[model samples]
Structure formats: C-alpha cells, structure tokens
Target: MPDDFAPTPTTLTTADGLSLEAQWAVPLKHRAKVVVAHPHPQHGGNMHSLVVSTLFAHLIGSDCAVLRFNFRGVGRSEGEHDFGEGEQLDVRAAVDSLAQSGDAQCPLVLAGWSFGADLALTCDAPELAGWFLVAPPLRVLGDERFKAAPDPRPKWLAIPERDQFNPPDQAQVAIADWTNAEIHPISGADHFLVGRTDKLNALIDSFLSAL
Candidate 1:
C-alpha cells in the first residue's frame, strides 16, 4: 500500500463495552466515508478478509476514507460472538467511528460481504447514508431482525449468479419489497466470490461516485 493510503491501526468500543480491532485509512481528500464488515467470524473472517481488504484499498485509492474491523470475538477483538445479535453493535460502532473522525457531512456508507452483508441489513444507524451488500444470505438472521430493507436510503446489492448460499434469483425475491434497493448481478460468480474482487471494487466505486 502507498504511504498515503496506509491504514492506521485502531480500536473501536462497542455499545456493550467490548473493544474491537480495526484499521482505518484516510485519504488526503476524501469524497466519502465507508465502513467495511467482513464475513462470518466462525468461518475465519476478519478485517483482513480478501473482499474486505480489497474494498478498503480500493476506497482509499479512490480518495475515500475507509474503516474495516473484526467482529467481537474474531482476531484480537474482545468479547464472544453473540451470533448476529451483538454483531449489530459492532457495525454501529464502526459507523460511529467514521462519523466522528473528519468531514461529518461526507456520505457514510456500509459495505459487507456474505455473513457480514446479512449483518449490515440489520443495522439501522441514522448516520449511514446507504449500504452495499455482496452475496448476502438473507436467511442468516431472521426477517424480523432486518431493519434496512424498508429504509428509504439508497442500497446496492451485488448478487452472485451462482452463489451457493443465495443465488441472484433468490436475492431478487428477498429484496423485492425493499425500498430504494438496486441489484447488480455478477455473472459466473459464486458465494465465495473468488477472483471477483475487481468487479466488486468497480461496483463500489460507481456506487460512491453517485453518492
């Protein structure tokens, strides 16, 4: 990573008083601010997950401040995983961290992959301007826990055509009633999204550019 885009290690304190490990990169002139969440913790996901790290690098390169963090029990982050329940607070802490840093008026968006994507949908932070979800398994948490589906803010979903967890068609049906939500299917990509980071990054760039 270039010196200008190097991430600064930090810690985020969640509402439940747990300290989560995190890394934040701020560009010289940021166009927007973003908080990136990794996949499931039990599945070996953390701040350094491929998709999360790639998005962090791409966002900083595009002159956007970005933050990526490990969930409660993952990596060096404190506390145990409360399934998708306590994780919501972790996401909110990330959003709060970015909101308090600099340029409070800049667009703040949340981007997540797989398990993290499902978790993001459950967060209804007022500071979040929108969301960008990648292959979210809409069934991870029950529908009753989801709060973003009806939100009027713009939301973009990058669904994988062959996703083992949730294919494009299933994702479409899941979000059919969601307000201001748009889907962009990635051809031939699966749930893991191996070798598809570039496309995801491009989609994110376009999403931020339009904000």
Candidate 2:
C-alpha cells in the first residue's frame, strides 16, 4: 500500500514541554510504526543528517509508519545537548507519542544510526516489537554509566566494512550478549555508509521485510 509515499512534517510536545520536530512517512493504509533516532547531537547530528534521512527515505513506502525527530537543542528542538542522557528521554517521548496514535498493542520498531542507535537501545518501551541499529557505538552504550540495552530484544546491527568509531574486533565482543542481535557488514562503506547508500537501503529493507 505504500508504494509511493511522501513523508509529512510533524511536531509534538513531550511531557516536559520540550517541542520536538519530526518527519512521518506513514504507510498509505497501515497503522503500525517505527521511530528512528538521529546521531549524537553534540557532534552536529540531527534528524536531517544524511544517514538518518536516508533511513527515513528508505522506509517511506513501507508497511510501517516511519518517524524521525530531532532531539533537544538539535535543529528545532529546544535546549542544549545532554550528550546521551536527555536524548534518551527524547527517544522515549517519541515512542510514547507514536504509541498514542493507535492501539496499545500496535507493532512498533525502533531504529537508530550511529550514536542514535545507541539511544534507540535506551528506550525499553514494552510496546516496541523490534530494533534496528546501524553502525552503533557498542562500547559507548555498553558502559554501565550510560545504561544497559533494552531487555532480550530482537535487534539488527548494520556495521560498515571499516567503521573506525567501533573497531570490528571490539564490535564482535560488544554484541555477544544480545540473543536476537545480528550484525552485517556493508562492504567498502565507511562508518556513515558514505557512497554506498544502495547497499544500506537494501540491508534496511531486508530487515524490516523479515519482520
């Protein structure tokens, strides 16, 4: 039903009165949804970043509603960046906003690229059906100080062939605890999947399709 969908711009205020700017490329007929998180806000990441936007654009015509939002201090969202702390709260707020759109049992997916992926794992909303993390900083999220990943989750980690942020050897050890987590390497792609979008899109599509 979503063969030719166009995303609609949206904004929602969280319980804390912070205004979040978002983009929703909802399916033409389906009501299920997915919320995407952006990269680290402190490093110039926002909802419009190339990788995040690509993820949003890749799923525009999918069966699930796709949501992408800017965190506090990033883009139109108010306040300064909290590194990962406030951003995690922002991600949960986005999840709650999407949950309120339909039945409580509606299927929901959470995806983040880079540091955003780490934030996605911070959201433990019981309503989420799955998670898709692209080029995540596994060590950063693994630190007990940041917080543990969502419980017993179904996750997909798309790592670039040569991501300098999280070394390949380190990633292998970091992903060991995730029972449903699977990691795939994109050949010749940088940490951001630079000039290899077609492969990135194909990988993302296959993951969602499997669900």
Please give the range of 10 consecutive residues that has the lowest summed lDDT in model 2.
141-150
lDDT of 2 by residue, 75-124 (tens): 88887777676677788888888777644555788888888888887777
Give the number of the best model, judged by TM-score. Answer: 1
**Overall local distance difference test of candidate 2:** 0.76
Where does model 2 exceed 4 Å of error? 1-4, 102-106, 145-150
